[model samples]
Target: MQDQTFPWLTTLIVVPLVGAAVLWALPSALRRFARPVAVAFSLVVLALAAVATSTFDVSTAGTHQLREQTEWIPAIGASYALGVDGVGLALVLLSVVLVPLVLLAAWREHPDAPATGRAAVLGGDRIRHYMALVLVLEACMVAIFAARDVFLFYVVFEAMLIPVYFMVGAFGGLRRRYAAVKFLLFSLAGGLVMLAGVIALYLNGPGGPQGFLVENLIGTQMSTTTERLIFLAFFLAFAIKAPMWPVHTWLPDTAEQAPAGTSVLLVGVLDKVGTFGMLTLCLPLFPEASRWAAPVIIVLALISIIYGALLAIGQTDLMRLIAYTSVSHFGFIVLGIFAFTSVSIQGASFYMVNHGLSTGALFLLAGFLVARRGSQRIADFGGLQKVVPVLAGTFLVAGLSALSLPGLSTFVSEFLVLVGTFGANRPAAVVAALGVVLAALYVLLTYQRVFTGPVRDGLATTPDLSLREKVVVAPLLGLMLALGFYPAPALDLLREPAEQAMELVGVQDVEPAYTSTSTIDDGSDQ
Candidate 1:
């Protein structure tokens, strides 16, 4: 809060936009400049976020940092407010870190993307434009995570669709147009529904003295029916974005359709929107409704967990399988949220960050394999372990992390979730625990089938991961290990925020086996 502490939010929000603009202005003739420019821009943002993180007082992370609140539409009582609490700050850092990695993920020379059919559609500065779109999307994500005002959050939330719409439509695979259209239509309809909730929150809010800032909206009274409806409106929007289950039909399509980089961001960062909205808005704004809807949400989350994994088990397309796996992982996150306990909430938060790191790594590594093998089909791969030891090893590490192997980041967080959920809802927790087992099955099975089999004669020439690919994957694996060993610092960061969240939800005084981690559910579905 000190004046000299740094304008952290501004730096995070602006650097990407500025970098993106410059990259866009660069001559298309200088095609080689695009990726580097994009990476450099992201690194600067990452550096700034790192400085903010390091200098940040971890103990006080529950409090918003370096907030900037200014009147936007005074008549409407909405303001342009920027702030980062423990959870938001953590996700912001994750989002920032992934940008450069995403750029680097697909740094390899890919095929010219079959210009034969869509020559007219794919014309001009395509690569640079893609890079620019990535930057733009990153900016929007940071803004969404940092925005303290619900209305501002909605703006950034909806705006993120643009870049992704193009990413899928532009750089995707076969059926890319279909996937893009589906993604766009689903996301837009959800945003519109959420917009109605935003308007209702603004217009019907406690208007005696101030406006509809999130800080003020909490604990405001609403009839249970109204709260439930508004909560449904909000939850529907986020769920579609989370792409949970039946609605999640788009994820595999989108993932299979998008380029590797786009999939990483889409699944890794963008999908977090759904879980994040629940934690940030839905539960707090409608606690009674959240409680009322808890059973249905938990059931749906369990289904997503089971169904996505089941779908993944049957997948032949590696990318589509990964996509389905995300839907399942999202199920865990949602369960943690609606569980309504501190440990579950914290676990959900940690899971989001971990999912970003691990899944992001998987998508990137998958992209690498696809690039070298020339196909994403499981049948296209036979024995890869013998040919690409490093690639196989990295894939194994990413796979283990995805499966929440003990001592990995996800293991600690997910364990806390199961433990915490057990404290609140034993049945749901038990059902969810089966998800962990299923996760292991899917990830390990996928790895075994794709990487451990005998080398198909055709891919006998598949080279090991190059130095650049190794460099890109190493940090993700390392972070997984580091966080697994020492999650205390992160736990401390979430403590106060989780406490405050619990207080609002009327959950209190629950003793747990683990003294450190707090976990709970945010009401999303139903």
Candidate 2:
């Protein structure tokens, strides 16, 4: 047997830490340099990920790649072991992709904040601090995806709270402090609960060569009670992050309160932490309990779909409306995962990346509109297409993508999810598809209200997107088009790792029938 020792996983963690340290150490006079430095660091990591991914031998995906294992604490049976399969690698790439784009979304723009009682989309006065926080937040998000150790995962998980908290509290909209507090309380409480679960997993694992590594957590013998408790503890934490129904009150407020750049990352990548945890930790660690809890979770997912849609329809603020739609989208992602069909799981994974890109773009475009028009009320943005044709067109593409228009990336992944879910659970899939219909309504409704009608008075005839904003959105739009047109390459990269994840979770040999992804080439290029 060949023993290949790669420090790639550690680099993923270390690169971000290096970026954060530089951002902190550099004086405010050099703050202008942070965005590019952060982007450069992120791109380097993405490149490293690509190399790791390129050399991956898919036929043997059941094995870990670029692994780095070392003992951290002798007493707790824990070690600093890290590695990636398909899921972690894909999310890590997605996180890297979004971080630079988010900084670009705010480039050349200041955070001129709105007052306490107003309805503003993206507003704040502290541009430097907001940008710095965003970079730091990206580092934390990347850590979450790259972390393979259970303890490291928990630390990074809670560490994410601080940057986003400041982003919301200091530079957000009218109720920034309130939203920040709400976000912190909900997150802190959940993290504490999950910490207990992580400790329990460490304590309960079978002694052997395999310990504290997610890949080694299979076939453990735990009582039904312990499994249930562990599952619930972790579930609650992820749920808040997932912002799933009932526990999701914090999301809309945070989205509404945070600046646009912050909201983009919040919805785009941070919220994914919850679903990722569900897929990575909850299902694999407590397989039987996940099965036990599936029915209950599915029910919550269904409710979130309906509730998110209804709330989105009722929202007047543009950013808040976008936030609510995320709730609905998250329900679909959750539903697919718990459904446990092979195709559904693949679709779930694909959905995470696709939704992140499409939704992140929409939030960015919406921010541009909000800043120019000085209001997020749908009534405030009429005939925008007349003054800013380019901006209107950009928003339209993102909006269409959000509604899963055929040939767009979202359509491909969401179709797979609905079909796969239908195969696994027909009734749930039926109702979930309704969420798709509501998606169209919400997306188009927002578009019509914001872009059609006569140009309202008092609105600035803002120019089209600046070079920086275009530089950011252009890649996103191109990416959406490219993926919508052809997804085989990405899917091929993902296949082996996802397959391996299934095996470790004891669901080996469960490949989704729809997993072939022939539809990516079926023709639809608008």
lDDT for position 176 in model 1: 84
> Model 1, 290-338: lDDT tens per residue?
8888899999999999899888889999889999889989999998888
Candidate 1 C-alpha error for residue 104, in Å: 1.4
Q: Tens digit of lDDT per residue, candidate 2, span 173-248?
A: 7788999999999999999999999888877886444466675665668999999999999999999998899999
Model 1, global lDDT: 0.83
Error of 1 at 475 (Å): 0.7
Winning model by TM-score: 1
The clash number for model 2 is 5
RMSD of each: 5.7, 6.2
TM-score of model number 2: 0.90
Q: All candidates' TM-scores?
A: 0.93, 0.90
